[model samples]
Target: MSAGNIRLYSYWRSSAAYRVRIALNLKGLPFETMPVHLLQDGGQQHTPEFNDLNPQELVPVLMHGNRILRQSMSIIEYLDETWPTPPLMPATARERQRVRAIAQMIACDIHPLNNLRVLQFMDKTWNVPQAERDTWTRHWIKVGLDAVEDTLCDNPSTGDFCDGEQPTLADCCLVPQVFNAERFGVDMAPYRTIRRIVQNCLAMDEFKAARPENQPDAPAPGGN
Candidate 1:
């Protein structure tokens, strides 16, 4: 498969979109990124055109050939299956399960509580103060990453990256969550294993290119 006509609807700072970007880059796939600003004009994703593309109105929607793919993890798996070189998954089924577990710990358990939509709802629906929301975000992030740190440290399978010295689906998910955590001032000192893995990941051009700041839609430095 040539991975022909690939396009991604993304937001620069969206962790979900960031994961997909990493997967695409790791697979050496060239893609067109269609920016969907989640905060501008009450969210470009809510627009009629975008709604037709994905009723969930979430970013990280991937269009490959004529197929429409939603959800960051699914998109990454699709890419991995479609393009197997530089495989992002381990060889055995059990190892793949471990990778998915780590990925979901962040994507499913941690991210939902602090995603922009949830924070916005807290502010608009209940009038949660910004400082309080920041606290809430930091709390959940700490709780989640604390478990992730233990998971990585305890598992002998863990190597330079999330699994076996190469960036896996787990690393794709982990780095973005760590980015959000750092942006909100969550302490990273406690997650030594995760910090080490993320450092290893960022050293790679694929991961560097997928950073939020490297995205075209990212706000100008010191301008946002």
Candidate 2:
């Protein structure tokens, strides 16, 4: 697909959607933003129009010409392969596997448990209280982060980014997960490497430009 033909369906606070935004910006690709309000009127994503685009009813859906794509990781891989400007993965298979491993540790293992739908299910089905819910979020996030921190720290390839110096797919996944963790009151003091890495990402204009607070659909400061 061409540059201007890209469109992203995103929610301001959705970390999965946020991941795609960062990837798009890093690739220097210009795209239109189609906001999918996740909290307004019981979520616009649940509507038939949005559901038609993605039967999964998820955000971060990409419309490239007539080809519709779902899933944040898959969409990002597509962008990297198609664009291939600032590469998101290394040339070597070993490094690519490592980057993907780190990304999946967050996307599959950690993030899925703390998604909005999962939290909603816990509340409506099990009647989980708010305080208990916060605890639930903290517990899972902390557990997953512990694994991520270990993965990054033990590896010799870790640098300013997740791999060497260039921002890879792993870094794209990390920054958003860190943001979501902070929102849910997961402290950063325990993970110095993660905090340092995220600081490096935030310093870059592309990552900063993709932040949730800067999104068009983002609420006013402190306004849900």
lDDT scores in order: 0.94, 0.93
Candidate closest to the true structure, highest TM-score: 1
Candidate 2 accuracy as lDDT: 0.93
* Clashes within 3 Å, all models in order: 0, 0
Global lDDT for candidate 1? Answer: 0.94
Best model per lDDT: 1
- Off-target runs (Cα >4 Å) in candidate 1 are none
Query: What does candidate 1's lDDT look like per residue over 20-65, in tens digits?
Result: 9999999999999999999889889999999999999999899998
Cα TM-score of candidate 2:
0.98
For candidate 2, give the lDDT of residue 188.
82
Candidate 2 per-residue C-alpha lDDT over 146-189 given as tens digits, one digit per residue, 9 for 90 to 100: 99999888579999888999999999999999999999989889
Least accurate stretch of 10 residues (summed lDDT) in model 2? 1-10
The 10-residue segment with the lowest total lDDT in model 1: 215-224
